[model samples]
Target: MSTTLANQQRSKIISLLSPAYLWLTVAIFLPLSAMLYFSFLSDVPFGQTEWHLTTENYQAFFQTTTYAKLLWKSIKLGLIVTGFAVLVGFPCAYVLAKVIQGRAREALFLLVILPFWSNSLVRIFSWAIVLRGNGVLEIGLNAILPFEVDVNLMFSTPAIVIGLVHSYLPYVILTSYLALQAIDDNLIDAARSMGAGKHTILWRIILPLSLPGLLAGAVLIFVPVVGSFMEPRILGGRVGTYFGTVIEDQFVAVFNWPLGAALSFILLAVVLVILALSSPILRRAQT
Candidate 1:
């Protein structure tokens, strides 16, 4: 009877998890597997297209320095955006989670997440309108200042960074807010009672305790930013060519699916290696 109950509980657990497992296999694993296979082929195995297994796609990456430089550029862009998001978001999160009271907190929290309410394309274009030469930002600034200053940031790296930071800043805020909220107030009070300074409390207590969430937010921002093409293409214009844009061109413009797949896999490998290397540090921070 005991054995039968254990078996029934195990079956129930499996049943509950089966749908999630199925979805992962169908939505994630299947596509990844297909892409991996495609990466090894000389051409896509569609219609009358002749194709065979080849390593040239992967070889092309190592053969050319252009892809490496673009990948590094994308990585740099990801780091810059993540850094700005953390620097800006953490303070806003701290104010919201620790300082604010009553309805003010709720209002500010709503504002923090306001970016999510609008379409990303709309937001990019809106920034473009403000940042373009002689546009809203330039006009407004020139009006305020004694001298005229050129303030065109559109179609530049700065524009890409600004747009990306605006888009992903909320992730850091939301995650850090949750982490900060979880810390007991008594712990902070106790530190104060022990004669800890404000900077000391923040550095030793609040920051350390909330680091996992910060790291989580950083990873969330970094990963998608690295692979992003649309924002760069629209915001950076002629200067927007990154690893992601290159891969996109291969697939969309050049119609080279196999090469695109190879580039995609290389990017995936790099991201995974980075995560694996940093995960130990993140885990250590939690302790």
Candidate 2:
């Protein structure tokens, strides 16, 4: 009777999970499988798929120096932005989690999230206005340093970095704050009672404990920044191309869907490799 009951419970569990399994298969797995399958086909002359399997797309990606350079640039940009975000966000998160209280803390949290409510494109355009020649930033700079020529800031690599950091800053702040808040106050107090200096406590106790949040924020910011198209497209202008823009052009402009799909997979592979390399650090941070 117990064996029969166990079987029934197992069957019920399977039944309960069946809908979610089906959804994953249909929504995620199927599309990914289709993309993989289609990526091997050659684009037919005159805008048709020949449907013959070929490795040319993958080969071409490697053979092209520009693509490699762009990939490197994307990686560099993502890392730099992640560093800046962490540097700016960590202290703010610490303050929010440890110092502030009541409505003020809630209000600050709300303000951090408020930017996300607006359209990203609108925000980018606002930056464009401020950075353009004779715009607000230029005017302010000119007033401060009249001898120095006012320089245009829009459509530069720095502009793209600033835009990406702005877009993703809230994620880092929230994650870090949650991690900081989760720590036991008694542990910190104990360290203080032991005569640990402020810097020593921060470095030895707080930073080590909060590292998981730092890694989570890094991963969250890094992946999107590398794959971002809009910021680089709108802000980068003709200065340079990122990998995302290349993949986008392959599909939309060049009409090479297979190549685009292949490039997308390559980007995915790169991100996986990065995560794999960082896994040890992430695990240690969590512990």
- Weakest 10 consecutive residues of candidate 2 by summed lDDT: 42-51
RMSD of 2: 2.7
Model 1: ten consecutive residues of lowest lDDT: 278-287
lDDT of 2 by residue, 113-220 (tens): 977999999988888888777888888888898486776878898889888889999989989999999999999999999999999989998898988887788889
Residue 280 of model 2 has an lDDT of 86
Question: Model 2: how far is 205 from its true place, Å?
Answer: 1.1
Candidates in order have lDDT scores of 0.95, 0.88
Candidate 1 per-residue lDDT, tens place, 1-287, comes to 99999999999999999999999999999999998999999988889999999999999999989999999999999999999999999999999999998899989989999999999999999999998999999999999999989999999999999999999999999999999999999999999999999999999999999998898899999999999998999999889999999999999998999999999999989999999998998898888
Clashes of each: 0, 0
Instruction: Give the Cα-based TM-score of candidate 2 against the true structure.
Output: 0.89
What TM-score does candidate 1 get on C-alpha atoms? 0.95
TM-score of every candidate relative to the true structure: 0.95, 0.89
Candidate 1: segments with Cα more than 4 A from true spot: none
Candidate 2: regions farther than 4 A off: 1-22, 44-49, 140-151
True lDDT of residue 274, candidate 1: 91
